[model samples]
Target: MSTVADNTTVTEAPVADLTNVLARGPRPKRPSAWSASVTFGWRAVLKIKHVPEQLFDVTAFPIIMVLLFTYLFGGALAGSPREYIQFLLPGIMVTSVVMITMYTGVGVNTDIEKGVFDRFRTLPVWRPAALVGAIFGDMLRYAIASLVILGIGLALGFRPAGGVLGVAAGIALLILFSFAFSWIWTMFGLLLRSEKSVMGVSMLVIFPLTFLSNVYVQPSTMPDVLEAFVQANPVTRLVTAVRTLMDGGWNTGEVLWVVVASAVLVAVFGTLTMRLYNRR
Candidate 1:
């Protein structure tokens, strides 16, 4: 059909033409949960590609922490920089890697601010994929941080008594713990209204946990009250497991505690983050 008005013309397709257009091909299939997650994870990685400076924390920060602490506490605590690095390497690794986990939340809040997630939520793909995939992309940063710290430690003559197996196991455990730990920040990303707020709270919590724990020195040397809190700190538990592994020992108690706690962090915070996500 055709019509003309105001020096303009409009034509409508017939019913058979409309039907042929819609029936041109079968509809595309929806993506699977895992597939969708990986796609979002790749999106996160692409963000890094476009903005390479985002890697500063995973690279430069860990290097600075290692050099600063190794020199600052080396002579007084362990008689030499090399000596202190042995005790500090694994702890520093844990600190650097764990501290970076909060960026996952920051990234989430960034996406939300850009309305990127609004588009994601409207897709027919899995709901949790975006979050999980973002964390997955962050796992690469965690690994890079660990490797940078490890390389610095090695260059400074720090050697794990547990050798290859121990170092590998330690890094693996740290990655797993960090993966679970990222969920807390993800929840905050959803609950908080701003990226600065998420970063502010994350720093407040992380500073106390990292500085007050057994990351820098032995908890046994601290006052009893401080030592008790140090012993109970989750980062302390992680450092213990990591240090023990690097020292050529298997402390099942410490390792199991970390594994179980990691599970709990994910189970609890993962649920909460998803709820916030769905409701958002």
Candidate 2:
């Protein structure tokens, strides 16, 4: 009986150890670079799909504003509605892209508050770059919004003298500017505690930036103080560059300044957003 008991104990020891190892199972492999980016991009796109209202604001508001402004003030400002529509189209495009910054910040805040980013931290991707990729992926929506606005402008008789190439260049410039502005708002979204606060704070800044520029009329037409503000504003430089580009003229200085300003903004705000992401 003693011999039988010893043999049983000896055999069970190895079996028990095998069972323990099996319980733990194999470790999960880290995600690859392509997989991580695709995951992040798809998630971002899905979020946009779920919240159609976010896109509606950009699409619907610009159309309404263009109609209202072109009809109401067009005759008074440009001696005819068609001319006013042309003058206002570029400004509207600039404002439309700038307004997208609000959504950038709000979206970032929503993801953070919901702990979506926390989940991303566990993935094998470069976390900072993932956030940027996600934000940039949304630029597709901005581009679409811009196109819709341009189409409306065309319908309203706002012809671009720059032809197809100039129109394409104008659209490209606005999208690039929007991407640069996204970095700033993304930083704000990462730093702010809530979505509502992000929206409020971003709008508070964007409204003045949009209106104080030569968006509606020539800077010379504004009051002295407003004219000075318009002259000093970077948006004015951008507007001038865009106007020249679309009007089929060459203003190298304005274009150069706008490019430089955009570069500086992207560098500064992009750095800040990365730092904030790292800390988070």
Using TM-score as the measure, the top candidate is 1
Off-target runs (Cα >4 Å) in candidate 2 are 1-39
| Residue pairs that clash (backbone atoms under 3 angstroms), model 1 | none
lDDT of 1 by residue, 136-169 (tens): 9999999999999999899999988899999999
C-alpha positional error of residue 192 in candidate 1 after TM-score superposition, expressed in Å: 1.2
What does the lDDT read for residue 217 in candidate 2?
82
- Candidate 2 per-residue lDDT, tens place, 25-137, comes to 67777667666766676777787689777678678988887888889989899999898988898888888777876788788788889898898777667777577767666
Which stretch of 10 consecutive residues in model 2 shows the poorest summed lDDT?
Answer: 129-138
Using alpha carbons, what is the TM-score of model 1? 0.93
TM-score of each: 0.93, 0.86
TM-score of 2: 0.86
| Cα lDDT for residue 268, candidate 2 | 98
Kindly report which residue stretches of model 1 are placed more than 4 angstroms away from their true locations once superposed.
1-23
